[model samples]
Target chain A: MTDCKLCSLEEYLKLIEHEEITYAQPHKPAIPGHVLMIPKQHVAIIEQIPDEEFGKMMVQANKVSMALFESLQAQGTNIIIQNGISAGQKDPHVCVHVIPRREEDGLNFLWVPKTLNEEEMSTIELRIKENLTVQLKPKEVEPPKPEKVTDDYLLKQLHRIP
Target chain B: MADMSPEQVEELKEKLKNMSPEELREFQKKQCIFCHIVAGRAQAKKVYEDEHCIGILDINPANPGHVLLLPKEHYAIMPQIPDKEIMHLGITAKKLSHALLRALHADGTNIFIANGVVAGQKAQHFMIHIIPRKEHDEVGIDIPEKLLSKQQLQQVKQHILPSIAKSLGARLQEQPVAVEQVSPKEQSAVPAPRHEPREVVIEDTPRKAQPKAPKKEHPKKDQTKDEDVTLDDIADLLGGS
Candidate 1:
């Protein structure tokens, strides 16, 4: 964990720093204005992140996207997450990539559509629907606790009266 | 229809130019088939639907089980979306990705958003493309890496850093992580604001907006029932220009 690059993002050019998320430039960017929104905690993948934290990350990502448009005058932006190794996640620590794109930026996020037979499509759909359950635990808020006034103060006052 | 007459094309362009931004947005929404799908005017194989979002099967998918999750509200680009909706989209994408991983027995998933035409946005309405992936799936999302020189990096930083700082104003109370490591004394120069203990955060309102109503989940048995034949071409045609 000590060696994780994202745990210590001090080397990178920092943009916006929140309590949970840190937006910074990649050491080797896909594009010039490309920045990464990384969680401060060492979460390996998206699944490991709490729902509220994930939502917070997205909020920050949108902010950075806006900044890309306003500050850099970027024509477009791609907010991409490469989840696992096969999806091109290099670091164990999950980071959301916000790349500022333009016409023919030489970036290839485009993929050719594969032809799936009816049976394959149906099976995939059914499987996903059956397993797709979004159980978002509502955020719990702690109520304010009133400060306690102890009777020990009265005894201390009596001693001081002498 | 692919080849329009020069005069006809010129006429359409002139008509478009005269419309105000609001009118243009309405025009874009009218032309956007995804908007039509959200409105229930167009047929779609919907996998999931909430008050704020709709997840539909992408007919022209990079991989099978590819889902295009969209906001119910029409927005041309990501920058136009409000923070609340953006948060909702993010959480929804995460849920969809979780489902894709578990159901498809896939190695991984990609949550991709194309914000503009240059970013490969085919539909004017912003949607997050959640694609389930496997090893050697031939889905080439491999972005070309460019290493910027020190001077070039500084220039890019100078351009964007201040605006982000200003936007985050009072929210940011600490120095950059890098700055803190190098000069701890300098951190003290910037007075820290008194951190207030946050009160009870009301649960987001949209969920309550449909509290008693059952979630609208349409799991279609017949994948091809009442399919709009022209639906497939709309994406192609809109992105053609």
Candidate 2:
């Protein structure tokens, strides 16, 4: 079995408890009020995450945003998540970046397009479509089921009053 | 603000029916009902809502399912809003698109945002238009020619590169792993494919091929017309040319 960094969903949730490792909470010693929202399941990309989980993630992200707004006195908040290497995802783990923004803070998020021509665009689109289509198809053979873990324990550990 | 009473809503509708375009524009300027809806001061049949924005039906719609996605906060143009806001807006728009697809049974939807005066932004308030389209419906909007020549496009790429690089550098400094660095070499190396014109052949039902035949030519002397018959002669004959 491949040793995936994000092996269990509960373990991943626990990682967020330590603000240093998870970076999903406000008041990290180094970066001020950086929050991350990730799926409880091992999903590589936003598209792969189930719709229900995606909705839950958004709600959590909103909560983080509200927290950041209140604590940091942030003018605005930026929610970003990179999926693959091409999209700047350094880690294989899927996570969202909730960075607080302030006026003239000099944080720029302009996408400098390397001007893809029609063919390159088509090729890239086709490649993405192929990968997504494969992922979307229902598996004929069921993979080994993950061990059932109680959500109460995970929730109690993850949620903290700050 | 409280919800309008039935009588009040009826009166409002009556007023709307009587009002001219100028009056409507003035009304919109003074206090936009849509803005009031976003601010939670007015009631609207909201299609979708998130923390940042809300999608509502266009009362006088171009189509049945036409909806406008307006930000809670007022921003005149796309550039004024940060990329994060744009991303959030996009996500919200995507959700709305899905809902519209399911509810309206639409074939597809056109998602467009008009920015600034040149982009045909009628209202001073910024909004995104999500027009739900049905098959064979006459939504007669012409697509304008916004294509740039290859040379012009290259020039634009050249012009924005410095600023893009600077911004990327600054962003990296702030959040080290925030952005993916894409090199120009990798970008330029990929070539676009060209499409060739296709030859179309149409089959006809049992048409007979005709054989060519020689034709006799008329004498050149007989073909010549008399130059003496002028417009004056026609006038003399029938008082007409």
Candidate 3:
């Protein structure tokens, strides 16, 4: 708690201050107009958040994004979170980074790559697909009909079919 | 839109000369549109809701099934949120990211935020974007990699490893959740044990003492920077914190 900078945001330079959530200009930033959105509490991560407040935070995040696109006229955006050390989280207090992007931002986050094999892909497909936001499955492709086959060819094929 | 009376305007002008950025931050939040959404005054195509946050469809989405998640209460940025709420948000986002991918049949998914204006934040309210990604979606998040020398990597690790360790608080320190050792699959299966940091210490002290004081107190001295403070540098500083 003593080390949590987010809980002590009042002591910092805030860009947008609210009763519960606070949007502050990050001292360090990845893009122009970069900002961090966080809760007023000292909880370290997102799951610890109450669902209602989490809802509000979600709203704020979107609104800010809309503003980025409209008010700031940003052509692109990338909102990212680094969870654990491996994921690149810097501090314990979880802050969402709202990055306004253009085609030329030359963005990089020390991202490492992993190549998923077919089995690994299927396993991931099984696990993460639960509670899908969109439930409609893609329709299967139909086999192509042979347009060149004339009535005689069809008759011949029919004889073979029997 | 600043609805102040002429006299109030004059008073505000009088205050403006001495007004701090902190005060202006409050003023901005009071007029924030998302705050209206949370308070039931505004309308949105909300997709998910719980005690902590609401997830709504993004009006300007990178792809279909894009979600904007926010807290019920307004806070400007990310650092102010308590660890538990942040943790909850992360967990919920993970679930939604999965759902978004399944629902949209997308090849991949991304969850991110523009933490500051330099990072592309427009609205002052805090939110997280859950975007479903496919090949050739062209979202433009492909950041080029800069390979560091072993010595430089060691220096960075030596500096930041401890700061991150301290954020674990007493609870995590005791259990020592080794993140590097946890595979992505294993982490997702039972996320709670991996996620549970020490709540008692955080909930009791800073939570109780969280400031709601008037803004005229602290002198705003941070240079409203327009420079590119890269993620790597921020990561390093945060690690060293």
TM-score of chain A considered alone, across all candidate predictions: 0.79, 0.54, 0.67
TM-score of each predicted structure versus truth: 0.73, 0.35, 0.43
Candidate 1, superposed: residue stretches over 4 Å from native: A133-162, B1-3, B20-22, B170-241
* Model 3 chain B weakest lDDT span, ten residues long: B215-224
Residue pairs in collision within model 1: none
TM-score of 1: 0.73
Per residue, candidate 3 scores C-alpha lDDT tens digits across A1-162 of 766777776333355445566665554455434557777777665546665676556555655555555423455555665433323455677676655555445564322223444454444334434353333245778999778856797788779984
Using DockQ, rank the candidates from best to worst: 1, 3, 2
Give, for candidate 2 chain A, the lowest lDDT window spanning 10 residues: A12-21
> In model 1, how large is the Cα lDDT of residue A30?
84
Residue A127 C-alpha lDDT in model 3: 42
lDDT tens digits, residues A59-139, model 1? 777777877776666688898999998888878889999887766657768999888777777777777777774444456
Top candidate by DockQ: 1
> On a 0 to 1 TM-score scale, where does candidate 3 land against the true structure?
0.43
lDDT of 3 by residue, B177-207 (tens): 2222112122233232333334422221112
Top-TM-score candidate index: 1
Model 3 segments more than 4 A misplaced: A1-162, B1-26, B170-241
Name the better of 1 and 2 by lDDT.
Answer: 1
